[model samples]
Target: MFKWKRKKKWYRDFVNPVHEFRYAMEFVEETLEEEKTKEDQILILDFILSVIREDLKYDTLTNIFYREKWFDEGLRISLPFPYHYYDEKGNMLSIYEDKAEVKKVDLAKECVLVFPWHRGRMRDNIKNIGRNEFQYDKFNHKAYYFSPVNICFVYNGMHSITAGIGFKKGYIEAAEYDVTKLFEHVYTDGLYWYNRHNNQKLEDDLLDFRIGVIYEISKIKHHIEKDAT
Candidate 1:
């Protein structure tokens, strides 16, 4: 009798988009069990695992790296810091630098405080309230459309960050006491917009830490992917 044997993948361990996702998570788990890590490295590994372990739709929704108008194609994202979304465009136009060494002051010096969320990109902050509602303050750089959905963008220093019940496809602006019990940390659960404010409700350390890990992972995935490629 003849039997079929499976072929092995030639890519780096836990690097491919397919089965590697599970391995990626395992790698992180093993890393944790193997030895202790610094906060920065922990942030990176946690994020990577969170993203890789998501379902398909949610995973696609989370890839908000490259910075460019919908028209740009040949462009791809490659950076250490997701200092800016559509980062390649930002780099070409001298808007945002992509070095890990750049301080928050550098971003402030350029008058850019925070980057907007791309397709499935998210923001990480610790607050008392919840709901994906962006504050409409003077420092606000992104443009927001409050219609059927919260559509946002940047044109000449206009960008947006939202805090509300928004879906994965668009943005929303909610109140401090607006978050529903949702899984903001699960990779494939899709993004459930949430932000906190001065109005205290409750605190879930695990949730906060997970959301933060998601941001750090999303921000740094491109750089890791580039390195692997």
Candidate 2:
């Protein structure tokens, strides 16, 4: 007689961290496929929008750069209603339903405005965790973030990450301006930044489109070190 071996659970403590992370991502992939109808095509964007809030078929920004994830001809996700609904006063009603919640329609009579939906899903995703595991704020300052370890620098002046954060955090926005300081990340937009104590405003940079994430996080490590000195 042969002795049978036990099957180890993937979630068992013995698994490596990297392997766990990869498996978690794969499980997310599998769930997207399961949540489909007979005629709908599944997409990767449907899964890793781990950050964005909408259950949209294709996000506008992602569709522009990563086109394959979206099915529509344009970046807009499919609206919940085939015909636009409005009150007697002509104000549009707010309805952020998924495609499943919507009714089939004859396009000739349908009208709708499918503006981007927002409920700040990213903030809800990582509201609480260990200090080593992060969200955005630290050292009495806030972070401009894209992903973990890809956050703003602790440097006391303006940098690319600051500009991006400034746009998101309400310190700055899309506009034309000139650069007076430099940072590790750059916004392709013509927007600019000013120092913490300065009252002056920057115009914009005509040439600042950047590809790839910039990591001056080594600078963050240095900032932490010098603060302790």
Candidate 3:
């Protein structure tokens, strides 16, 4: 007979104190892994930027998407960048579609400014829950959800890296800096703790890029439809 025993507080009964500690540790470990991944991403971005800075001839910037793999552990993710070009006036050029119409803008000449997207309190709550599953699952059986923070960089044809964050409006502008330095900072900081502890090497991975591009394209298409109205 498969009889389900119903306790007064099913959560409290099933989740023990020791189990809670184990869950907390797991969450901490996962957080460490995520940090390491972010560091690796920064490293790759920096490398690409350095190439851009060194050689001014190569002006086209292509979007890169790294596929996620099981072997990647925490180092697999996507990276996206716009096709960056320059005008005769030393202006940064980028193309974006507005309402089914391709629009070109000179970033350097335009007054357009980008701000970092606010990763709202809801996202923070999700992150906390992902880290503390034991406590979360005890209170509610619902699955945990987390919104990841994306770290981006701006690079010229030569190799240099500039750190920035994405926004709903567009990419935020970061200070011009070296790519290697960015990677070193991330590796030395709290980011790479888990990878170092686990003896893992960061790889160039970009699974998120593939997924995001599709969504972004779809959104652009929708925007175009809206603009035609």
What ranking emerges by lDDT with the best candidate at the front?
Answer: 1, 3, 2
Instruction: State the displacement of the C-alpha of residue 124, model 2, in Å, after optimal TM-score superposition.
Output: 27
**Residue 186, model 1, lDDT:** 18
TM-score for predicted model 1 compared with the true structure = 0.24
Poorly placed runs, candidate 1 (over 4 Å):
1-16, 36-140, 143-185, 189-229
Clashes of each: 16, 9, 23
Tens digits of per-residue lDDT for model 1, 5-91 = 222332344343334334444565565566554454556564554343243213222234454433322223222111212221222
The segments of candidate 3 whose C-alpha lies over 4 angstroms from its true place after superposition are: 1-78, 83-209, 212-216
CA shift at 135, candidate 3, in angstroms?
Answer: 13
Mark the regions of model 2 whose C-alpha exceeds 4 Å error after superposition: 1-13, 37-140, 147-229
Total residue pair clashes for candidate 2: 9
Question: What tens-digit string does per-residue lDDT give for candidate 2 at 48-121?
Answer: 33222221212322223343333323232221111122333534332222122212211112111122122232
lDDT of 3 by residue, 1-229 (tens): 2234455367678875345434533443444356445444344433433333322211211121122222311222122322232333434433221122212222222122121122232245335434442121212211111111122222221111101111112122332212211111112111221122333423323222222222222233333345556
Report residue 169 deviation for candidate 1 (angstroms). Answer: 30
Best by lDDT: 1
lDDT of 2 at 229: 67
Error of 3 at 95 (Å): 10
Candidate 2 — what's its lDDT?
A: 0.26
